[model samples]
Target chain A: MEYPAFLPAGDCALSVEFGDAIHPEINARIRALREALERKPIRGVREYVPTFRSLLVLYEPCVLGFDRLVKKLQARMAGLRGVAEGKRRVYVIPVCYNGEDLDFVAAHARITREEVVRLHCAPDYLIYMLGFLPGFAYLGGLDAKLHTPRLQNPRTKIPAGAVGIGGEQTGIYPLDSPGGWRLIGRTPVRPYDASRAQPILYAAGDFIRFAPIAMVEYADLERRQAAGETIWEVREA
Target chain B: MSSGVDRTLRIQSPGMLTTAQDAGRVGWMASGFSRSGAMDLPSLRRANLLVGNDKDMAALEMTMTGVACIFGCDCVFSLTGADMCAALNGQPIPRYTALQARAGDTLACGGARVGMRGYLAVAGGFDLPAVLGSCSTGLKFGLGGFAGRKLRAGDALPLRCPEIPVSRLSERVLPVPNALDAHWRAQRPGMQLRVVLGPQAAHFTAAGVEAFLSSWYVVTPASDRMGMKLEGKKIEAVCGYDVISDGVAPGSVQVPASGQPIVMMADCQTTGGYAKIATVAGVALPLLAQAKPGDKICFAAIDVREAQRLARREAAQLRRMEIW
Candidate 1:
């Protein structure tokens, strides 16, 4: 861990990097600063992405000069310590652990299928940042015991809502994107529905808890969700 | 009274990669959405301005070529960016000037001979619904533009025109001291890009940074709207090229394990894990956009203050010359 650094992304944007590593404290610091900016507001700042360890802030160059903007950001960040995260909610994702690679992951980890499920559903994973596809929540807190390597050859198209694990990371694909992640399960809920007013359901810093569901229940939930019914609710964490 | 025309541009033959685009889809990068839009943004603005539409009005962005279209109505239009070898019904037409096209008049925009990507803007702008506050096509997610994808043959793009005034139909062209044109011409052969050393510049060794600045990288064929892969010197990074995935801004020059730089473009994914050495200045992005694959490009380190200053200067100049 180093001193909070203001690294320049470009002329119009800057990355207020908390650290080079991805730690919960580093991420929390980045999120707190973003939350403060979102509430009180900065005039020139257009948008901000609170990622794993940095807050990449895009601003209008004409409105606020680069040097001045950095000074302003520095002043705001000075008081961010112990500042609580604005709002945190855990979205309970229903996953049917019957994916093609579920057994493979269990075998690789030298664990039973039931043990794998228990480990996967145990921790409340933190949404590090959304990337690759829209509403694709990159989760943290994956149990080390279930850590499995990605497939040797990437799949052409992993189905949307396909819960997969690659290396140490576990995330659900919001779109049918080509990925190397080992598919362990499937979820019925759509994290991203463009038809909805807010295209994405959850933002970075939100928590995600995967709840195991049976195949029959999964089929029924999938059908209901397809028909625009809300299957899962956000639990205040 | 209005029996002579209709408000639509019927596509006879879609170009290589024709799609509707605006300035960009702003305010959604945090949601993992790329600012998918016209590659040569200034050209899009200029075309829109010539046709008397707002600077960011949606227009057809024909990449590496121009689209073949038939005017459904008598409308004022303007073509800008790369010399698309455009012709009006078998006759070569002029770009950067407001031109009148009659109903049923055909426009054939051929392959680019100058730069890559052409913009065709009609008066009153395109009649397309904006998704996520923009008409720019985000093809990766199948969102926005012509049903969220590139144009195909027989696609009828409607126009929002309430008849152009007869008095306003005079031949108006963009006046001299064209900065965008000058900028494009300046970056021709050498095609040097100015960059601000990065959020992850420390990830690379000092010699690596020096090598990156010195080497002349050629744009690879795999380059597209997503990113431009460059190959030249293998500038090694300290430890490894992997970073704990972070926000990647447009023009973020990322170096993966291979040690080659990949300049993220207009439609690049919002975030990446590769260690970024530098970020190309936004002011120089349009120049880079016009670069063809195999074009030799190099980088120059510029300070953030100077970078923002140049951007502001260009924007202010464009604003002044916009209505003139």
Candidate 2:
């Protein structure tokens, strides 16, 4: 277990970074800290935000100013390395393999389109972090054979739930946003819905599997979701 | 004071681009939420002060004016910012001075003759259910304000007055100077934005980093609450480098592929992959908030201690305003 230095992110916030390189263990610790903070919020703590390898904690300036908060955080961090044990949840996200860049990715991977789908679904990828957009989970453990670069020119607007790969990671767009990731498929599930008790269905450290579905099935899922339906199937991992 | 939803103000005209704003949203930046709220912090504070409302009280933020409202009940209110040529029931009213309007009087605010934005504050503050503990409108994320959207015609806003009127403040409060005030001379416009060099600051070439500190940047016309598109030194690493997606905050300076440094503002998304060079000190955020499009700004580097002191002093000044 390793811990990097803690530093100020900006005024009113401090970032405790774990490591420079993206590692599964480091990410797990990050998730653990996030969980612990949420489960037991500090008195003056306003926010505890997680990144790839760091946790940015924001507190109210009036109640617990930066200096005092830093001391409290330092004491808290001294013993927070071992409380990450948990039961992880695995979700099966159905994706329609009809993205605009699916063909280009298959060509780059030197495989047929069918094989790309198979490899993508074979591994149970872990959610490393939740960032960029709401419900947009950054999943690790992509198949090396499926590694691809982001598009040279990003699309002006990638449809919501468009699943794509960039470098060694893959994620779903929670909203209709401009992106540059290499697109491969799109899911029908609303990655983020404000009305739900838990707006984000997935969190860091959870595992996810992308099961490719037919275009017709995608259309049906979209319809059911629009009518306020639960689109994902959850299984304990 | 009704236990029910309280008296509601019906919109006769929704002003040009009125939106509800309070202190911004928090804790959801990693979820791609922007802390969208009032653009001018000091003025917003003043407006809240005049009404004896909490500093985080929600107010109607009018952009460039044309908003007309009707009081639902007898209430006390105050207006701040550019002379909107406001009137109460066809009688020309004064800006920056608290006014008492009876129920059914139409309060109209016209276009700006000076500044860009104006704030309207009720005695108790606008009544609205806070999303994430804020009534600030972030139209891009559809998070807060009235349904997380801009105010439109016929949108009836709820009014909730405090139990007592502002007995402390005199009825007349002078208009806040559109320019920096004499009180702020000690905090003089540093023109230079203090920054704590970011983790990605090392990614750029030494020369590039030096240029960033040395050069002057201007806030472009394209700037808004989301971010400021700056025109200055085209800063880059030895080559365009790819950085892992990371969390961002307001006042972060990011150099995208275009090589121009874009300073993220109040409405900026929480996370981004761009190589962030620096984060401007939060004490200077209010000054940045007051910047108009095409305003000239320069970056000056200061240590974190100085930034904290500056923030403390400014906050103390704000607290002192309560006495008057």
Candidate 3:
């Protein structure tokens, strides 16, 4: 693969563009660069934000100038190696497919509600990135048959743990806020908990699989989660 | 440091949008957290210096209006950023200078006369719990600051009192004239913010880029800490506006389908799908922070190297003040 183009984001940050389009290969390269920077930390490098096809590197200009940082980043890229596939963790999140927009989604896809649930749960979605909101995971690999457009008018408030599909993408809202995605279900697991040792439950390269549950089980899991129990089951992918 | 004395400040009236902030929450963008810090960082550092506190010490960042609080112990403090017409015990106090306040003294401030935000730094900084390695408040996540929210009436904030007397040191050390001089320039209207063409500059038409540089954009009333919405000539996009959601840096000038540009600020999200036309230089970010609604702004394009030089010069000047 050719070296990514380095573009100046601002005086304090630089964006290394791997590709113009979103692909798993490009995302893997981004994750590789992030891991390299982490293992061999660079001076003045304040933060690393990885997106679908690029990595935004923010640094302190006082300690490292833009030109010098660019040279260093280029050298690092030259020696970049592909990340070896490790034991990836797949989190099984329990969800009750009884959201307000379930019927709307069913009609839009020209499929029954049961078909929508099967299509949604069949694939282990890849976590592309986390953004838009805190703990909000932007996941990929949604079934093309279940692709639904976002709402024309966004709701005033979408409760946290609302699993929704927007176009070809699908995600879970970790916090309650106004959103426009088509809600299909609600998860009992809280992806974002400030009281937890680690606030966010998922990372960029993790996989998530949804498990359908009954309303009674959903209520019981909610009670268990509120009582400080880990409800999501994790296993090596 | 002894933890004997319990010094505190009772909030009599919490102004518009007051929150506890330090330098910022760093190294957490990967976890989906924005660096929520003082919008006007230079002023925050200067205010901390005036109060003989560390440059990154947590202080109260007050918005357009200022907060009113009563001190439970004698302490020295300095007000910076905007001129809020602050008074202590009903007597007017000057800005950019450290002043002593007696126990039970009530400090009040009125609407801003100059900039958009103000900083109030106590002697030893506010003694607030750190969340994710910062005292700065993340309003979106409700993670840090005083209960992860803005200050309100009847709230008492604990203060870390210094061992040595701060009032005595105030007489020996005076306010840095260079720092104050730069702040004066920031208060002036019609700021020309320098920016650099972006990673996606090719996405826009040549005329669109020209219109962006030539037009004077007025800050919209919808502006907030997230971003500064600007109203100006429509910068027509040759390509579509949507892009694969990517990382957004602070000071990024993103042009959505609406044709209007929005300058991302400190509280902006980690990733955005809009195409970026330009990004404001780091040295000029403080100027954008001070700009209030209805303020006029113009843009000038500079290369990445020039932007880095300007940033270095600003840092050198701040260092000359002996604050950091």
Candidate 4:
């Protein structure tokens, strides 16, 4: 399905909203639009940020006015009518089911905690967007059984590496910040680092799977991460 | 026009909060880049004019209080905005005036008494690395200006002293605006900002739109470059469309779920989903920058053409005022 072009964001940028609702197909188109822009950048184009259901393209007004830029973007969209291919990457992230909300989540879903883990690890999730905070990925395809609401009162500080679930979406808190999601486990990798060449570890179109591990192994992995050793058997799946 | 590198300004004491800033980072909002730069562009411009520098030159943005420093060599510099009481080895120096500081002499600025921010501009521009087209410091994303962070007490500042014809600020050299400047230059009374109706203006009810322009809103303590959260009548829409995320710009006023209007300033995020009621014009940005907490403000409606006219007129006046 094609999307409608939006008006200027301000004086310098424009937007193209794929759809009003959150759907997998719409998100895939959003990714496709990003790739299209990446492949053939506009003259005055500075950056293109892809969101869950839309894409924002910022440009220099001096080089290309709002009207001219919009026309250029529209032409690009029309050129890619039928061939919308979103690039995808698959990653395996190990986790331990033992958590403060593990038992509570099991009771809420009317299933065992182990069963909850089984359902969660079943499907490969796709990253729809990267927002709210830097390196915080908004992953889709969460297990229906594990779908849960946010906390009544957000915690003052959710530690970095926390793997959390909110509704049908699951995410990892790349940095220590105030959050209200239910944390099931954590990953030791630095999902975000400003000093690094690539600040964000994962981008949109990447696939992710959470692998279950024993509690002792979690502690051992933490030690390994602290010692600057690779924790996960992180290989491209 | 091309000269050699001049003496580097050695830092003696980094003040409370100081960072290198140029005009601002633009053209990267779609990439989630914030427009992080000097909060007060007018003050920076005035200071730059005093030193005969371009409007886009990099300067030090000091907040509230400032640090003590010793110039490595004699150089012409100007200080503007706020009564910080800058001094040379405890001797008082005039504000909004350029002065030559000799080497081995210490310069310091006291705390702000009226305003929250200040600008200190050297004869030439400050030597700093430009990141993604600007040297503006954005600490949140950690990009641009002094390693993308605040200047510490021990940090050193480099200088590029261009040997151009010296220009002093007097009646002859000072920027003389035209009739428009003479009329509008009278510092606007109070904090009310003139705005053009937003793209989402249609979403608001007639009463909600009326309340938005008629009522007075207070600038809260939580206000910063990211946005100004106004406290006033809670505006409710006739219907809410969980707006699809779209690009946003500086000066866009977004009315979120809480009904409070958040006026985005420089350093705001690239895009948001809130229903924006209006957008402050770029020409009026200087006035918005001077706003302080507890300041009561109102909104006045304007058309897009009027906004563009105001911006163009301001640019023309600015060009006529400066040598560049």
Best by TM-score: 1
Error of 4 at A68 (Å): 2.1
Off by over 4 Å in 2: A1-3, A65-67, A98-104, A149-157, A166-168, A180-183, A214-229, B1-16, B64-68, B81-96, B104-115, B165-194, B204-215, B236-242, B257-259, B320-324
The docking category that best describes candidate 1 is: high
Estimate, for each residue in B163-239, the C-alpha lDDT of model 3 and write its tens digit.
55774646424453333345446675477889999967878999999999998999998998889999999988887
Tell me model 1's lDDT, rounded to 2 decimals.
0.87
Per-residue lDDT for A1-237 in model 4, tens only?
Answer: 355656445554455777777767877777776788888788988777777777766665546666677788778877774325654566777787766777777888899988988988898887776666666777788878889888899899888888888877787888888988888777666677654455456776677788888888888888986776656553453
Please give, as one word, the docking class of candidate 2.
acceptable
Alpha carbon lDDT of residue B54, candidate 3? 82
Report the Cα lDDT for residue A122, model 2. Answer: 94
**What lDDT score belongs to each candidate, Candidate 1 first?**
0.87, 0.76, 0.86, 0.72
Q: What fraction of native interface contacts does model 1 preserve?
A: 0.83
Ranked candidates, highest DockQ first: 1, 3, 2, 4
Give per-candidate clash totals.
0, 3, 0, 1
Per-residue lDDT over A136-222 for candidate 1, one digit per residue giving the tens place of the 0 to 100 score: 888899999888988999999999999999999999999888999999999988888888877898998889999999999999998
On DockQ, the stronger of 2 and 4 is 2
The A-chain TM-scores of all the candidates are: 0.96, 0.90, 0.94, 0.90
Better of 1 and 2 by TM-score: 1
TM-score of 1: 0.96
Window of ten residues with lowest summed lDDT in model 2 chain A: A1-10
DockQ of each: 0.81, 0.46, 0.80, 0.22
Per-residue error at B171 for model 1, in Å? 2.0
Cα-based RMSD of candidate 2: 4.0
Off by over 4 Å in 3: A1-3, A83-86, B1-6, B172-189
